[model samples]
Target: MMTNAIIPLVYGLLIGKSNDDYNQFFEKLFEQDNFQPESIMTDYEGGTIKSVKEMLPNVLHKAVWRQVQSKGLATKYREDESFRLKVKKLIALAFLPVDDITTAFDLIVDEFDEEADDLLEYFGKTWIGEPKRRGTGRKKPPSDHKL
Candidate 1:
């Protein structure tokens, strides 16, 4: 899909939503040299993000703000007004310098403690790609099953 200042410029409806589907969409788009865009805003779809990075490595990728907020509503903190507000702040961290986003994110997570533990884990794993580890801070032992 392509847009110009919020107006849809072009788009394609695909039967499947997969990395390959997105790849095909973007690959075809690249055929037009003028299709290169400055930035792209989209929902946090893993396949779309991966395809976008692979196809338009130079273009900035951003999450759609409203969609991001809606995700927070589905998380564990849904009922807490304060938590919701904090999440909005957390999402706004994208506006900060890249180097500062992680520290600020951690601070917000720490403030909620157990209440936001699940949400924190989701954010860390999905967005930050934080490595999973044991509570002791040690890496898990390798699986015993043979390949």
Candidate 2:
């Protein structure tokens, strides 16, 4: 479901999960002519991401934290309970303000050893994106894509 509110509005449901299915959904959605969305939240589906970028240029897109957490647990889990706790904190960075996210992430990375570096790098580049620049000029509003 594509949601603009806490209770997401159902966009479309398809029998098959494919790029064409997503494209069809978006095509029907845009047919309304007044369905401009400021931002969109999705799980880590490559096809969905591609479709959203192709169909809704300039829309802000973010990976849902629940999906990211499960992915991290599957890929980066360790026997140490403390390490698991740290990874949980890093995963929770999705809730942080754009300005504070990068610094908080770096601190967590520093606390962990090289074992989690790949996970951290993936989170940094794919989810948090580059740190937002602090300056006075017409700063671009931060989003998942452009930091």
Candidate 3:
């Protein structure tokens, strides 16, 4: 899998970090080397995710542990083994069958305490839509499991 591969194909300064910047970078990479990786990984950057989906629609997009840092859970992930495990469990939810993610997410979130409320809310809003102020069941999720 691309995740386990040893590859660092590019390193340079970016004028900015935006959907436009990433899009142009990817376009140039393709123009120069005709490069199109099987997959790309990111730290939960919205611009990167948007560009990857736009330019490399056929390629897989994966998120690494940097999600912890992005969500301000770095200290908790490092010091609290239980929270770390729960976070890993949440990440693991990505590998589950798409139809099964909601159930698995609910199961993992059940173990979270108030410390994880914001993280849970982040996940709920980003990957799975939260319940409405008034609803019988969950709203249709905003992000697909692929995210």
Candidate 4:
């Protein structure tokens, strides 16, 4: 996402099932006209994280809790009054103009440190190259997958 100089802009949510699939998606994103962002905030997906670090090392990265809140199971923060109020505050904080995107991210990170830490720890344990069994050689049909 492109943003005015006063605020950070974020774009795209291309999820993939494998590292190669994720790489191809990011390649497409990079091909869009001058789509280089100064920073990107994303969920802690291993393939995406690896791709971003390797492909855009200079960009700032901030991991957000919304990613975890939305994964696997449905999240009900939207239905709870206090949670809704907290989300409203976060949204307002996110949109406030800052000197740069980094500052904006720092604000976000600071505001949600507990949630962010939980997400980071979860990511570190789940996605960072821990050993796993390779399944049988049957490949799933493309139509059956979304990522």
**Count of backbone clashes, every candidate in sequence:** 0, 0, 0, 1
107 in model 2: Cα distance from truth in Å? 0.9
Candidate 2 local lDDT, 82-124, one digit each (tens): 7667766775665577677766877887888876666666666
True-structure Cα RMSD, model 1: 11.0
Q: Please give me the total number of clashing residue pairs in predicted model 4.
A: 1
* TM-score of each model, in listed order: 0.40, 0.39, 0.52, 0.34
Ranking by TM-score: 3, 1, 2, 4
lDDT of 1 by residue, 1-147 (tens): 665458557667878789899999888988977887866766667777667766775453344233444455445344677766766666555456655666677777777756456556666655544654545222222321110
Best by lDDT: 3
After superposition, the stretches of candidate 4 with alpha carbons farther than 4 Å from their true spots are 1-15, 63-147
Error at 5, model 2, angstroms: 30
Q: Which residue pairs in candidate 1 collide?
A: none
| Local error of candidate 3 at residue 118 (angstroms) | 0.6
Tens-digit lDDT track of model 4 for 48-132:
7667766675453343244446442115344555544443444333234433423343444454435345543343233222223
- lDDT score of model 1? 0.60
Q: Rate the local accuracy (lDDT) of all candidates.
A: 0.60, 0.63, 0.72, 0.48
Which whole-number lDDT from 0 to 100 does residue 74 have in model 2?
A: 41
Candidate 4 structure lDDT: 0.48
Question: Highest TM-score among the candidates is held by which one?
Answer: 3
lDDT accuracy of residue 122 in candidate 4:
44
